[model samples]
Target: MSRISVLVVDDSATMRSLIAATLRRDTDIEVVGFANDPLEARDAIKRLNPDVVTLDVEMPNMDGLTFLEKIMRLRPTPVVMVSTLTQAGAEVTLAALEIGAVDCVGKPGAGVTAAEAFGDLAMKVKAAARARVRPLGSAPVVEKREGYSGGDKIVAIGSSTGGVEALLTVISAFPENCPPTVITQHMPATFTKSFAQRLDRASAAHVTEAVEGAPLETGRVYLAPGGHTHLEITSGAHPRCRLVPADPVNGHRPSVDVMFNSAAKHGPRVVAALLTGMGRDGAQGLLALKEKGARTIGQDEASCVVYGMPRAAFELGAVEKQLPLGRIGPAILDLCSAAAPGRDQ
Candidate 1:
């Protein structure tokens, strides 16, 4: 395989050098060029045509968000945003992701060691290089669905990699009164909390980060917390969310497998969907759901950024249906409504 060529774009010379050197630490990644600003980056992009771009969220002449929007609108290449470890920077970085940035890394602070920060940046860059990003004009569009109901139905959704944009589409398609939904998206604690907030702002349905002992209610989507805690379901007269401390399963503490397996065992009628992500984290758990007679769905390859988890599930005979990102929401709603008759929320 050819090396992943990268272009580092930042106004600060130190940042540019630091990012370039960090990427160079991997023999598989090559620092093709460095750009001090968007103008310089534009020229480098035209000249070098690198595989990935490491973009600083704050830049001179034009901001990173604006440049990112332009890239999504025109070029459609994967972009990894470099942002400060601040509240405002977090907000801006999330905005960039919505505008088509593949992923983000917090810039090392005065107190943070560069080695540690760049270690993460290198991984994100490699992931970005493998991601399939759609241009802004041609991206999937999911409209808000109506007539969705909660009929003793529970939904479990899992994703990573391309999940931010994918979940935005899937959750926005839900009605104001939808089934009780649980989600596991691989992310950091800071990013997961911010993501829940962002999704709450964008979606008609209530979306919040899952808290231990929270009741599973209609019209709300609970996101598993990003930490050493795993989210599970406790079946009874009233299903509720449970947060448990456990070793990372499949290398994720809040692993998709943990959530799926829990829901399948406890949920009365489970509607499970695995979205785009890398690796085999959710495959066996999704299969477990299928064995328990739960309705299973997977995002199809053409719409996936990585297609690893979904593909693994599909090949394992776990997916009852494989749909595009835009269609998965409606299909999930359909399954929930059909699972139990004579109930609507």
Candidate 2:
């Protein structure tokens, strides 16, 4: 079989060498070239035509975001961002994903082992190589106008890997009257608090870490605390977050399936979305939601960081509409407002 070719782009020679070395360890991946900046990367792209590109967020000539925007506009290919593990870095990484990068990996500084910095980089690169590329013009941008006027409703979403950015994009698009949104994005316990806080700042909805017994309210968003499986509503009259200590489901602690299943039981006929992520975490639960008559949408393969979960759901006939990442939020609003019996909005 042909190996997956890669291009490493970073202003720092050390980082570029480190990333290239780590990726080359994987027999299936071949580091075809390296570039010091976006301008240099452009020439490499025309010459080598690599299957994927590992880009640094901060660069000299042009920042990764600007390069990503240009790449999406001129020639959309799979790109994975390498960023530091700071709050500022997290915010920029999220923006990069929204702009067009397939996924992101945190960079480890000196004294950190390659094993540490490249924790999941190889896997992400492999996934990106297989991903479908779409032009930036075809990608969805957040809308400034109100798209829905609906009564109290709930929106349950779940994702992993590239979800940090995907969730932000979807939630930020929501208006003040947007339905109560609950999310279970796969992340470490140490990061969930910061992630929620960051999302709260960027999004209109009141975002907070899910606490046991907290009432589910419209216009507020809840994130399932990491390190535990957060199940959906237990009762119809009052739906609250349920966190449980259990073995990881579908290889994720805060599994999407667990949340979706809970949502299907508690918020029957509500709107649900399964965004980009690895593995089949959300597929079965989404199928259950579909069976319960909830409007379900899956991120199209072309827009996913890793298409595993969404593809599984799509193959199982669970998704009602397969949409690009940009259209997901609007589609949810439309579904909530449409006249349907048993649906709150």
Candidate 3:
């Protein structure tokens, strides 16, 4: 296979050099060029046409988000954002994913060693190179459906790259009486709490980080805590969340597959959604869910940030419906309602 060429974009000379050096260490990745700002990056993109770009969230003159918007609108390519691991940075990085970034890696702190950060940077770059790209004009939107029965129905959602925004969009459309929802979104330990809090503030549903023995209740949303795998519905009468310390699955500690697999075993008749992400993590688990009689949905390629996970599941016959991001929420409601006995036909 040809080497995966990359363009590094950052304002800091030290950061640029560090990123380039780290990428160079990987035989499969080649640093084709470096740009200190979006203007320079644009010129480099036109000239070098690297397979991927590692972009900084902040830069002089033009912000990375603005530049990223243009990149998606004009020449869509795989982009991996390098952002600080702060609340503000997390918010912006989430936005970048919604705008079409394949993935993101937080830059190490000031006191941290370069070797550690470089290792992570190299991995993200390689992942970005393999990510599937989509046109910005044709991205998926989350659609809202009315007239959902508020009973014992359950909803399980999994996502990675662009999950924060995509999840917010889908869940926000849910009414206060929407079904009990459990979510596993790829995020760091420090960020999951804040993310759940943010979601709760934005939506009508009560959102909280999942805890062991916590009952899955209606009108509530549970998010897998960071740094731990969250298994679903261990007990039937009062479905509770289980947290376990395990090795990362598909390179994520709180993997979507782990959650979805558990859901398949415990809540086979529930509704499952596989959203935008960068790898084939949830594919097998979604297949398990489908085999066990769960209604499964995958975010369509056009609306995905990377289209890796969903595409993998869809190809494996794991997904029952491939819908745009906008139509997913309503579709879930429709599926659940159809399964109900006395609901409006």
Candidate 4:
């Protein structure tokens, strides 16, 4: 019931003022302190102990990424990155997310108003305040397994808030010949391409931003391109990606619900999982897939950053099984195996 206290960290006075003013607009959020750089930010963090921190991706003296790493290693506080909406900025923001930031929002660029840039900053800060921040450490090492024959089954995953690190953990464990997979991670239009590239670099399976008419082939992972369109799967002997330009579902253009509903048409041939997120976007869609006999999984709460999407789906009886973050990747692969049980079996 208490207000969410926030520390604003940025080298730019303009940005600090803008961020502080924007957050103060929300009745539930209070800007507790400001820091011109990471050194000042460090002292502010120790003194104010704000529930959340809004961090700029690039700052003077100490870069945000290094400071974020130090914070996660030493203190493990919830953070939301404020970044520029450029390709390079996207890469850095993704890095910050992987380093344990709960979420991110872009800075106002040329022709973009401050309001447009930070419209959702307060909401994200609220979510960050509730996030489960993990200390920096070695990721769980998933032992590679053999005997995978994915067949015609397609895999769909949905995530939000802390998805960058979660998705990296999940997808990096995938084998070279993993099943066709599609992901709808909540992100900005400028970020998905870089994220896909990041995923491709980390995982054995090839990952890319989804394009209309692309075949959903084995060993390929399609990430829904954020911003203008929703990624859907078309059913046929050979399934393919479909990008639909429609109104945002669940307040998101690349809504997980749209993707899951589309994949649901494949029935038992589809396998879906909802990972750590901050809303109910994918709950009903996962339930629809379950009703159509698809195998469904949810990331258990202990491993979730926000525990929103998976919790919603689990409550709706959409998840046939729930597993930890480290286990979800292999579990999905197991479900997609050719020898796995189907609707008739």
Q: Largest TM-score belongs to which candidate?
A: 4
User: How do the candidates rank by TM-score, highest first?
Assistant: 4, 1, 3, 2
C-alpha TM-score for every candidate: 0.92, 0.81, 0.86, 0.97
Q: Compare the candidates by lDDT and give the number of the best one.
A: 4
Task: Enumerate residue pairs that collide in model 4.
Answer: none
In model 3, which runs have C-alpha deviations exceeding 4 angstroms? 110-115, 118-120, 130-139, 229-231, 338-345
Expressed as tens digits, the lDDT of each residue in 1-345 for candidate 4 is 899999999988999999999999999998999999899999999999999999998888999999999999999999999999999999999999988999999999999999999988898999999999988885555545567776778999999998998899899978888899999999999999999999999999999999999998889999999998999999887889999999999989899999999999999888999999998999999999999989999999988999999999999999999988888887888777777655220
What ranges in model 4 sit over 4 Å off? 141-143, 342-345
Error of 1 at 21 (Å): 2.6
lDDT by residue for model 2 (1-345), tens: 999999999998888888888888899999999999999999999999999999999988888899999998888899988988776787687777767787778788567676876877888899899766667755458655354666556788999867876788788888776777889988655467778887888787789999887788877888988765655565576677777778888877888898888888754547899998877889999999889878889999877867888889999999988988878877777777634434322
TM-score (C-alpha) between model 1 and the true structure: 0.92
lDDT of 1 by residue, 234-289 (tens): 87768899999999899787999999988877534888899998778899999999
Clashes per candidate, residues 3 or more apart or on different chains: 0, 0, 6, 0
Backbone clash tally (model 3): 6
> Candidate 4, 121: how far from true, in Å?
0.7
TM-score for model 4?
0.97
Q: Candidate 2: which stretches are off by over 4 Å?
A: 11-14, 37-39, 109-113, 141-152, 161-169, 187-204, 225-236, 245-247, 267-269, 301-306, 321-327, 334-345
Ten residues in sequence with the least summed lDDT for candidate 3: 336-345
Model 3 per-residue lDDT tens digits across residues 1-345: 999999999999999898888888889988889999999999999999999999999999899999999998999988988888788887788778768887777787977567865556776677677666666756555566766776566789999877776787788777787778899888776677878887888688899999887888888899998865655556465677888789888888788888888887654558899998877888998999889878899999877766888999999999988988888877777766635632321
